[model samples]
Target chain A: MSTQASPETVAPRDGGDGGVPEPSPTAGRSGPRQRRSGGWFVLPFAVCFGLFMLWPVVHGIAMSFTDESLTLAGTSFVGFDNYVEAFGDAAVWNALGNTLFFTLITTVPLVLIALGMALLVHTGLAGQWLWRLAFFAPYLLPVAVVTLIWQWVYQPDLGLANQLLNALGFGPVGWLSDEAVAMWAIALLTVWWTVGFNFLLYLAALQSLPDTLYEAAALDGAGAWRRLWSITLPQLRRTTVLVGMLQVLASLKVFDQIYILTKGGPNDSTRPILEYIYDVGFTGYRLGYASAISYLFFALIIVVSIAQLRFFPRQEG
Target chain B: MTGAHPRRHDRFTVDRRRFLRLSLTASGAALAPGLLTGCGAPAPGGDGVGLKIWDLFSGGDGLLMDEMMDTVRGGPDGFTLDRTILEWGPSYYTKLAMAAAGGRAPDVAVLHLSRMPGYAPGGLLDPFDLELLAEFGITREDFPPALWERAQWEGRLYAVPLDTHPFIVFYDLDVAERAGVLDGAGRLIQPGSPGAMLETSAALAEAHGGAGLLFGHVTDPAQNWRIFNALYAQTGAAFDLPESGPAIDTDAAVRVVSFLQELFDGRTNPNHLDYFGALASFTESRGAMIAVGEWELPTLRSTGIRLGAAPFVNVFGEPAVATDSHSYVLPRQERPDPARRREAHRYVAAMLRQSLTWAGAGHLPAYQPVLAEPGYAELDPQSSYTEAGDLAVLDPPAWFAGSGSLFQDRMSQAIQPALLGRASAEAAVDRMVRECADLLDQPNPVR
Candidate 1:
């Protein structure tokens, strides 16, 4: 994944400014000197990354093999016991299923709706600033603020949602209380809160597309829809892929909003795997088992990322 | 370069260096007091025995606690108290456990009596020095026997009981009067059986044009468990979870769940109110009565509604209401300072002695002397439910079963669906039993 960007950076340098300059003495010397200095520059981040991230990742794997607990009592190697139990654990499977479902529902709409909003805004609409601010403002709010706002909006009896429904001659819906509807409610709130980033990405991609192709198509009497399908969409494929990957990953890792809103409830219908792992490790005090479940989730995420990368290989210009 | 350019650059360097030095001195001056205080030398209230306390109290309860602490601060006991109020529930408990385990725990911390088994066995709490406590006029006889027994683990006192907050009935006096459910004494008529309770709720619902009884069973696991445990206990059923499995009478659980389902009938009680919603409904007089922990008393009183409170009535064969007590525990400390420990004991004793003030928030005082006070008897509505503390049935003792514990979460998951009509009562009971059995089958992490 890290290597994927190397070609793009190297390709631009090789092709775009080929005859710009012969290497000066300082420029030639900078290769080794900069490398030496860069080591110093990276030291602080490297140290932090090693301690906070790398060590935890390594220690967590080690702990997964033992019966470690938050109680700080005696711990003993349990070999494959925790993993074996997790594999057969109904709760783990249920949580994983919910997470995947959330990812699917949130990702598709986040991508499509963002693209639609970006295209709408890019069409030289009036009140463009207002549209942009309204579209992107939710993303600026913190998770706690976002959940608090949505919780009131999703209230069953007195909330705006049900009031609107009632005005339409429909009965009140239990947005956060009904098991079947709870996840959808969370997904809806999440889309509202985070779709802005994707929208901005799409809008940037749209703005950057060369106008020559569209102009030529227009000269040949191509309709707006025809031009959009042939030029605009194809030009924005990379952005779509980027947004889809990011949205899927973000949705998969969702915890804060759902935790604050439902605590994954109406019967654990909205509980993602991360919350389950949290409940097990912290609330249940079974840290070892939680670590095992976390590693399992980690492996699943790696497989998903690899599959996505393989399917949507990034195109280097 | 010209000579003038070098002098100009030198002057700029001197000015920048001076500016850096001045800013450094300014920041250092600003941070000095904070750094000194952080090192624990000169305490905030100088020359007093400083004691750090951690509590999970917020909203009405938090304000009352603060007032009580202020009284103690101004009392004859020259103790400086530093209290850290944290969010209630798992976040508080988890942080307290970690702090205790790390040997940097506060001098004293508030813990629910139901959580004693989990914390004590894990060595996160140090047993109280009973002799030291007795010096301050607190003894085993000071608290009710059942509550006192719960404050111990393996025959050692790990907590000093403060107050027992129980699930009691709160009613709108005006609504009850209009519905003709009030007795001659202006008290809520006791509903002796499930049928009678439903009848009362129906009448009240008609009077109020909304739900008669609001339980807030939706999306609130702790409340659901409290209501279920209270009703289930009334059936006089023995509930025991051994390694083999749950030995509960399944019929009793099913009956409790079914009764809850009926009570939450859309007209009699709203089916989709969370905890705050129920509080709002009752406050707004939309609901004639609400069944919840008495901690909501302050919120209800502030709304200026004519409110009446009563102990939970006997709906089954026996009388019971789910309850848990707030108690002070000494979080485990390595190489504990003797003077500070004694101060903690003194502080806890003082808090218990002055618990009549705490009772203003609707928690029944566990201190016998406080309960016997004329002031306590005079506390309207609060005094009306004193019997609930006696009839209190706490969450069955287990490592996982307690207020804000995973057991409550599991119970909520098992029973919420039934309450919502998505599952049958029998299915809910089965799920509860199966989940209990699963928890019991696992290794006790605390040990």
Candidate 2:
């Protein structure tokens, strides 16, 4: 069904400006008036953005400079002290390392496994709808529900994972308790829960690939494997880049599942930077220090994003 | 172009206008009940004294508290109780702090006595009127001196003592009998010392064909700290937090950690068990005994297991156990209502009088009168550990030391490696001293 509709959907993008209809002759004369009317329509969104997003950013930056706390205690301006302390904080460094390690482990598998699933589904597998649904269903679940299910599965003794391993003559493993294995277990669950979104992206990219290229490749005696390597993979390059970037950014921000699962325990091995901020701010009652650490993390994310953009510059038509 | 489809456009515009009107009317109809209800309910209690109480009680304790609240609601005092049960731990405390800071806190809330120093000094809680409490028949004399003193800050009473929940031992009666560890009165014969405790555990292990004791040492920092504190306290070591650092006795701390290592050597007790796992092990008969807080009494009883409980045995020179109390505190209010404050005091007094019902869940009541009652002593297993209240060793007074506080978290982190056999007991003690120094170096954020 998607095959017949692909050409019509793909035509506009490949054709670029050629696919555009000519503007009305009076458009230039009425443009300012139309723009004025459009401003009214955008005003509500502009107000919301300024209030919620812009205000918090400005306020948080201001808060990072003081000795603010959760107790509404007296505050003092401690110029650069919080930041200096954060730089010297060993816990902050440890949490950041854990976050980086998690991003490294989860991103590669999430991207590759998603692509494999999409490729299988795009090959006209029988019951296309079922395969697509099965691939995408886990992404629809809330993180709480996902963690609840995985918590049971990861239980050391009576859990299904160990039961299966025991049946196979292997000893029980502490999936959530052993310091060495906790992060890997959390990463595995995260991959299972979120690989669906990436799969859907890849599937759409696969479906939208032009059929004429495949036809030409087949005419040149290209087998399925060669076609996949020489044509399909290269065609999906932009999609792959997008998927990889999104996966890394998403993985770095991980907190909910790990927080619910282990509270970053078995000696804080799985604690991410975000959980550290939460612990310092709410649990430890040190909001100003938490804010400084937050800005440091924010700066790190920006640098990583800029590097990604520079290395994989967007493809222009 | 405008005139070409003028008639059809006119009809479409009219239909769109009608649809908008109809949709608006439909939405208004849908919202009518909610709007009415929002304004219709009379201030919750219709001129009666309404007390909003927040507590962190769940499991068997939650059910018992619910029953107590129900009785108060139905009593002749004409008091209406609005209760909220929050999740126990940092989340609950965080929300309470935020609410109190914002001046929108509940009339009364539960606060750990150990946490009183943090909150009371910060003015997050208002001092209670002793005369008012006395009017309600709750006096300072009614509580243990240590608990009452801990509930005060800067010479004013900020909390009313509730119950002291200490680290205790739960054993399967049948398993203990099979292992011949019970005494003449069916009480668990005291292990008395570390070596004797290990010997008894070995015997129990032989009888049960599994770990003799189930101590949840994995991933549960609170449990780790509780057991450590209880054992360390038994050493008669002085623990004080000074500005320089935690004044923990190094040799005593190492001794306790070494004993824990031997206890969790994978035979006497499984080192990998977690909170729920320990409960399961004890209930499933895989372990002869489990060492945990007395709070698990009702849960174990529900499983239909033949259970018995005793106070934490003396493993060193002194008989001491780490304990904390769940007390009632009046959170600071922007505009304190005299009548509502009075009602809160009454509610707490009423709850204290009903301590026997609370005792069923295994906490020793702080109200001394309740302990003297015939009914309290009749409670099996619960009454067995009444001495724990006197032997209680609360977390040392510090801004960061309390149940679910940062001090406990730090202690747990430092000691967990040793418990897991990844670090030496001496090294773990060093880490503990260093971490406590770090905490001491951090400026007190609670003011």
**How many backbone collisions does model 2 have?**
0
User: Which whole-number lDDT from 0 to 100 does residue B413 have in model 2?
Assistant: 71
How would you encode candidate 2's per-residue C-alpha lDDT over B74-162 as one tens digit per residue?
Answer: 84675687777888888778778877775667889999998887898888999999889999998989999988888878899999988
Interface RMSD (Å) of model 2? 14.5
Report the Cα lDDT for candidate 1.
0.81
For candidate 1 chain A, the 10 contiguous residues with the lowest summed lDDT are: A10-19
Off by over 4 Å in 1: A1-33, A314-317, B1-49
Q: TM-score of chain A for candidate 1?
A: 0.90
Consecutive 10-residue window with the lowest summed lDDT within model 2 chain B: B19-28
Model 2 — TM-score against the truth?
0.89
Clash totals, every prediction: 0, 0
lDDT of every model, 2 decimals: 0.81, 0.81
Clashing pairs for predicted structure model 2, backbone only: none
* All candidates: DockQ: 0.19, 0.20
Candidate 1 lDDT tens digits, A142-213: 999999888889877778899999999999888998888999999999999999878877776677677899
